[model samples]
Target chain A: MDGGGSAATIDHLFRRQHGRMVAVLTRIFGMHNLKLAEDVVQDAFCRASEIWKVDGLPENPPAWLMAAAKNRALDAIRRERTARNFAPELDRLLRSEWTVAPTVNEHFGANAIRDDLLRMMFSCCAPAISEESQVALILNILCGFGVDEVAGAFVSGHAAVEKRIARAKKILAASGMLFEVNSASEFATRLPAVQRALYLLFNEGYHGACAETAMRTELCREAIRLIREVLAHPNGAAPASFALAALMCLNAARIPSRKDHSGNLQPLSDQDRSQWDRDLIAEGLRLLEHSASGTELSQYHVEAAIAAAHANAPSTEATDWRQVVSLYDMLMQIQPSPVVALNRAIAVGQSEGPERGLMALDAIGGSERLARYPFYAAARADFELRLGHRDAARAHFGDALAAARNPDEKRYLAQRLAACGDVSAPLQR
Target chain B: MAEFAYLYRGGQRPSSPEQSQQIMQKWVAWMKELGEKGHMVDRGQPLEQSGKLVKAGNRSVTDGPFAEAKDVVGGFTLIRAKDIAEAAELAKGCPILERGGDVEVRPIMQMNM
Candidate 1:
């Protein structure tokens, strides 16, 4: 029996239960004491870890955690000072002894959990919150991630993420966001922001600058989990959201081959196709088909189509490069950005010659945004290497190395640069 | 055998899944070692930081025994060892130290009826 596996089961359950538990507790504790509710949930995890260490795994872990948290809430209410600080909403509900138990029970009931979680999720990503803050709020409040975990997922430094989340939480607390279960129209208006946060979450998981592979994949799994929450609700599953989920599914399917056995980075051109998760690819293809049902052509739809082309191919050489290039074209038409342009150039390299790809890259070089981007220089180096421009490849790789965020990337670029050694050296003469 | 309290202090949670797992494995191994040596009284409970201290006389409440994170005693463990030195020796095995935490080993007092 693997202890690590059991530990992972506990971790997974925490994520699954944390949001629902927080939602219900928030309803009982009131909006003002949201931080207190979070504290109680953290306490529950501590209790679980200790008890499980001694008695082994419980028969029903979630029930155990809920009961522990409920008792803690009771203890808090018993305390005069804390109870007096409850928001008016909760204070009124808890005024009488007769109403207190039933009120807490009613709020924590199974039926209320799902609705509460949905409402809280919507509240976290409300249009008023900034984009990055919204993502941090969802991860911290809804997903039960710590500041460190949130930082790791987003590839942001810890101190910055801590401050960002703190500011976001203060704003949310001040907003006194009511837990209104939104009607379809209200949900429709806010779905885009929620989708954007989830999209960013998924992209960070897929393209994280983080050195650790496990941490990166955990983010991807979390994004998929949260995206499922969006799709579970009938009105919340917009076509664009579905497209985004399909895009994640396709990208995630390739995760197994993304790193080598020694945990170094593996480029797509060298990755083992047999290691690709076929189940995830099939699911992704299914989602892609579903996404096509609505006439709305989200950038995600185009991106997912491009990913599907890659997933369906037997090998890099066998990939439908033309299809990828066209989808990228569509993506550029919808969501024009330096990153999109960079991706298009790479596909163009595969479809046309390396020279054409270099030209496409040069056209986008005018953007100040791509100047510091390591991947832009890295892409240029890849094309130059293919075209036998050893000196140019070395220079571009050096630029990439200078801009690399993590040691893994720098090392990879260094190796690529070393491979492009000059035949025009004095030693060769 | 005598009981001692091992007060845990100052360990940040691991920033990554891999780091957490590695830390957990060390903890599990240490616990197993204690159990094998018949020194494990109980695995111990982790304490949450939010607590209101009941004042000496007026019964006014102020926030927490340790207001700042560094001064906070995160949790305590009760373990049986032959002597204080043995208990202190046991603290050396604590996994939290790997993450820059410390263990304060103090002997427990017993009273006769």
Candidate 2:
């Protein structure tokens, strides 16, 4: 048997089980005991790693983990009954010897675990928490990402990320309840925030300046998984959720071509179209169509529409730039940000000539907001190069290279800078 | 080739899911390498931390095997090698060493009955 396959299975088993066990234990132990819940889950994995080394692997690893975690939960409850309180709702029941086992057993059921996971997701993204903290909590608590991984994703330090998660958890515990997932009105009110958090999560993964391709994909996959969970529930089937799902799927479909064989960043113009995943593109299109049933027009809808436009095109030049420009206009109306305006200006560049693209960039009032944005300089450089303004193009490319976040981006800009003197160089297609 | 026992001693616990995963992969890969080299005899089971130890003089059983946390034998595996040196050399590849654990390699006495 191939060892690689088994290795992947074991890796997946541990990470996936970490999330599952934490969610279940949190449900039984209460939000205040979040750290305790994590400790219990961590202990279970530690045991598995020690034991499984000798035994190879159990017949059903998930089942084995589930059983192990259940016993640990029971042990924790019995040992701390006097010293600690559980989910306020279950406090009395968990304290008594008569009901503690059954109470723990009831929550550990497969169905309960599923609900608990969703509850955990919603709680992590609760509106009271800051957006950064929400993202950190989702990674740490819901996705079982370590502090270091969260730090890596944010491009921040370990201590900062740790503080953010701790603060978010404190706010969560003070609320003293898992967001009631079954309440329709509350779900409606909070669904948008949850959707936003997931969208941010996907964007962080897709457009991450971080160098680790493996981690980028993991974050993207986790976002997609949680989004699907949101859509699976009856109350979570919002039009915006469908649009968000489509947006993620379509973008994720292009992940394979995001980097070249040497692991350098590949801009959309340079990426080979054939490398895009057809299945994911198809699924994204289907979801986009489904999202159209409702009249609500979310930024995700317009964004997904833009992605669908690109997905359907045979090439970047063949893509309907006018249609893309219109979608961006819609996106601006729904969500006006400097980044959106910058992208809109670039789309205008594609549809119009180099002169018009330059004018559009200049017309974007408060353009200084994009001064630190590397892509803004890069876009200007592209327009300048296409217009045969070699001196201007060279300067802008230098600016872009200086502003670029990662080595891959810097290399791409450096290459573009080198081409400014090549009068024979063709305009970027 | 002679049968030898690999007595795995205490190691540090993995702090993160990803780290635990990497450690597990290292182990599985190590064993696969041994198996392919025809050195793996029997992959053993881990001994539970809690167990009974029978006292020799009193002929009484009590909850024991309470070795120092770092010295306790956590698990064992049986393998075939040319000799103790070869077995010890092969044991060097065990993942536990990365976590500060050690492996005691000893040959099983052969009976000529």
Candidate 3:
């Protein structure tokens, strides 16, 4: 076996198998024994690590893991049957030697594992838990993230993340309903919460107020991967889900150019348009079109439209700011926030003028709410600078610099401030 | 070249999926590196934490290699090296050491039957 090849395959298999094995085991063990299911999956991975390190990867890595997990499941059932209850539904079936292998095998079947994963996703996204906890649970259980990775994603402490996941798991297990996919109406109501959690997951990665670009990308990729799971199920293929997928894909397409090789923040204007992933953009556009069939206008639809507009533009100057402004208007109506208003005001600056943009920003009802947001001040500074109000630009840039949390963002703002000081420099558009 | 044994000891189970995957990847990569460097002899198996420990007199057999106890011999590997010093140096690259486990490097004595 080629060492490098086997190592890379094991890494991929670990990521792809970890959540799946857990989900399948959870289906067998019930939500109450989620921890036990996780333990079994962990055991399988540990066994694989030890064996595969020497034996090299099996011809069918996933099948190998499934076999390992199945054996572990059988062992767990046999050991604990007398002392504990398994999944309420399968407890009886699991207790009998005759049915045990078949029962575990049934759940571990390919189709069963996919459905179980969907159920696990919905369970993690249950509305009973807070959104933050929901995202953390999804990362931990569905994306196979460790507590440390979850903490890294959220820029939180290990203890806090651990507690959050535990509390959320308790709530989910206690809910006694792992979100059965039987009813369309119930599924419809629950889908929004799931979508929201996934959106937040993607945003945390893309915006990444936290450092560690690699981890941030991992979050985004996981979000995309899990969303595809939701989209794969017949009931999950709603317009909003399509829109959500579109929004994620379009925004993700720009991730390559979002930062320079040295990791400095690259503003949309300065980003290398050619570096944008065209394939993702195309897929996003197709999803956007699919999303248009439904009459319901979701925040995702509006947001994805804004992203599509950016994706279509050859450069910042070529972008249809008017269309972007209109989309922002729709987004504001759907999901009004200071962030939306701030974005709208920036678009207003581009489509209308710096003067109009300032007026729009001032007219925002909760303008004070955005006082701490670095981009709020940065947008104002951009408008001020473009209008040749160097003094005002300098002040706003200074404010942005003070508020910016990310070092790259802070450096960008500082550079903008310094540029404001150089009066002889040609006015940047 | 002489055969060397790398005895892995005292690493806890990984607490999370990410950590589990990382440990596995590291071990695989390290083993591969060793193989590429012409040091690999045989990839060894991980020992079960619970096993029969027989007394010399066969008067008692106990279950353990207790996992909870510190410094439990967990797993091992075999490698080819020039000497004890080279074997120990090669053993330093084992992934278990990253988790604060020790690798007991001992030469497999050549025997004539």
DockQ of each: 0.19, 0.47, 0.64
Ranking by DockQ: 3, 2, 1
| Candidate 3, pairs of clashing residues | none
Q: How far does residue A344 in candidate 2 sit from its true spot (Å)? A: 0.5
lDDT of each: 0.78, 0.86, 0.86
Best by TM-score: 3
Which lDDT tens digits does candidate 3 get at residues A362-396?
Answer: 88897787898899998888888988899999999
For model 2, residues A90-158, the per-residue Cα lDDT tens digits are 999998889988988899888788878888888888878988788888888778788888999988999
Ranking by TM-score: 3, 2, 1
Model 3 over residues B3-112: C-alpha lDDT tens digits? Answer: 98988888766777667767777787788889889988888787776788777785698887645555788777889998999888877787887887788998888896
Q: Give the candidates in order of lDDT, highest first.
A: 2, 3, 1
Model 3 bad stretches (over 4 Å): A9-12, B66-68
* Model 3 accuracy (lDDT, Cα): 0.86
Q: Quote the positional error of residue A188 for candidate 1 in Å.
A: 0.9
Model 2 misplaced stretches (Cα beyond 4 Å): A1-5, B47-72, B107-113
The per-candidate count of clashes, in order, stands at: 0, 0, 0
